[model samples]
Target: MSDPTALLQHTETRYLLCRASDIGEGEARGFGPLAGSRRKIIVLRRNGVLHAWRDACPHYSTGTPMAWKTDAYMNGDKTHLTCHSHHALFDMETGQCILGPCLGQQLTRVNIVVGDEGDVFVAGPTEEI
Candidate 1:
C-alpha cells in the first residue's frame, strides 16, 4: 500500500484547480485525477478559507474516491467531508475522520495556494514536479 502522506508533497509544479470564488462558502468541488492517479483532488471552502485534499477515502488499501457523483464531496449537512462509499465523515478543518469506518484516519491533504488574484493552485504530484 502507498503512503498517502508521501504521495504528493513538496512539489514544484502547480496546477490551477480553480478560482477561489468558484467555491461558495461550505461548498466542495473535485478537480483532476491528477498525475496518473485514479483519485481526484478535492477543494472546499469553509468559513471563508479554501482547503485542498486528495479525494481518496482512507477505508481501503489504495483508497477510493469519496464522492458518489461529480463534485459531491460533502455530506448532506455540509458540515463535514463525506465518503459516499462507506459514509465516513471527515472534519473540514483538519481533514480528520471523525466518524464511520475510518474512524481515526485522515484524508490526504494537498498543498493549496490562493493567489492575490484569487486563483487557486495545488501542488502537483511528485512526477509532475
Candidate 2:
C-alpha cells in the first residue's frame, strides 16, 4: 500500500492504516510515517463512520502535524480534530478548521478503502521523501 501522505498526489499505492474496528466511536488514532513519508495519518471513528486525514495542519505555508503527542488528535472534549500547536479545531466529517489560526481551511483528506475484512487502506503512490 502507498503512504497516506502521498494520497494528495492521487497515486495508486495503498497502505493499510488500520482495521475499522480498531478505532471506536468518537476516538482518533495516528498511524505511520509508513515507508515513504514523514507525516502520520489520522484515522478516526465518529458517528459510526471512519475518516482519514493527513496529520498536517493547513495553517502554514508548509503544513505541520496537528498532534502534540502520540495519537493526541482530538480536542479536550474529544469532539473535534485539533491542532495542539495552536488549538485549531477541525470538523471530523469535513476536515474543515472551525476555529483558531486556520479558520475555514481544511486538513488534507486521504482516500481510504475499507476491505470486507475491516482493514483500512489509504490509496496513493509510495515515494521516498
Candidate 3:
C-alpha cells in the first residue's frame, strides 16, 4: 500500500493510512487528506472491521483540524464515536449522528478497504473538503 500522506501530497486518488496492527480492537486513530483535502479523518477498528470517517463533530464540526482542543472517543458499547465537545454520538458503522444535539446529521464517510496484508487504504470517492 502507498503512504497516505504521500498520496495526499502527490494528489493520488487514494492511499494507505495504517496497518491493521496499528489500531487495537475498538480503538480509533486520526488521519488526514481524504480526497486530497486538508480535512482530517478518524480511522477506527470496530468489531474486527476497519472504518473511516471525517473527524469533525456534527454539532459544531469541532474535531481534528477544526478544533484542536476537542476529544472524540468510541462509546463504551463500542458502537458509536462520541465527541467530548458536545457529547454528540455518531454511529460507528455508518458515521451517522444518532444522538445528542445533532440527530439526523452525520460525519462524512470515507471509503476504505482493508488489504489482506493488514493494511488500510482509502478506496473510493472523496467527500467534499
Candidate 4:
C-alpha cells in the first residue's frame, strides 16, 4: 500500500483547480490532484475566503470527494462542509471536526493562494494538522 503520509509530503504540484467566482460565498466544493497524491480535495468558501482540506473523514478514513447533492455542504447550510458517510460537520474556515465522533480532530489543510486573475492555485506545503 502507498504511504498516504509520505505521498502528502511530496505532493506539491498545485494546479488551477477552479475560478474563485465559481465557488459562491459560503459554498463548499472539492478539487483534485492534491499535493502528494491523486486523491480529491475538499475546498470551501467561507466568509468570502477560500479554504482547502483533505476530503477524507478522520473518524472513518473515508474519502469524501466533491459531488453534488452528496457530502458537499452541511445540511443545506452552506456555512460548513459535511461528510456524507456519517454527517460529520467541518468548519469551513478551519476545517475542524466540529461534529461527529472525530470531534477535536481536524482535516488535513491544503495550502493554496488565489491569484489576481481570480484563479485558485494549490500552492505551498501540505500542513498535517
- The top-ranked prediction according to lDDT is 2
Candidate number that wins on TM-score, 2 or 3: 2
Clashes of 1: 0
Off by over 4 Å in 3: 1-13, 34-36, 61-72, 75-79, 127-129
In the predicted model 2, the residue pairs found to clash are 1-14, 1-15, 2-13, 2-14, 13-124
What's the residue-level lDDT of 102 in candidate 4?
Answer: 78
Which lDDT value does model 2 have at 23?
A: 97
Q: Give per-model TM-scores.
A: 0.84, 0.84, 0.70, 0.73
The worst-scoring run of ten residues by lDDT in candidate 4 lies at 63-72
TM-score computed on alpha carbons, candidate 3: 0.70
Query: How well does candidate 4 score on lDDT at residue 129?
Result: 18
lDDT of every predicted structure (CA atoms):
0.84, 0.86, 0.71, 0.69
Model 3 agreement with the true structure over 91-119: per-residue lDDT tens digits: 78888778888889888787777778877
> For candidate 1, lDDT tens digit of each residue in 82-108?
999989999987999999999999998
* Candidate 4 off by > 4 Å: 1-13, 34-38, 61-71, 125-129
Error of 4 at 42 (Å): 1.7
Ten contiguous residues with the weakest lDDT in model 3: 63-72
- Tens digit of per-residue lDDT, candidate 4, span 40-77: 66667777778878767777665544344543556565
How well does candidate 3 score on lDDT at residue 69?
42
Candidates sorted by TM-score, best first: 2, 1, 4, 3
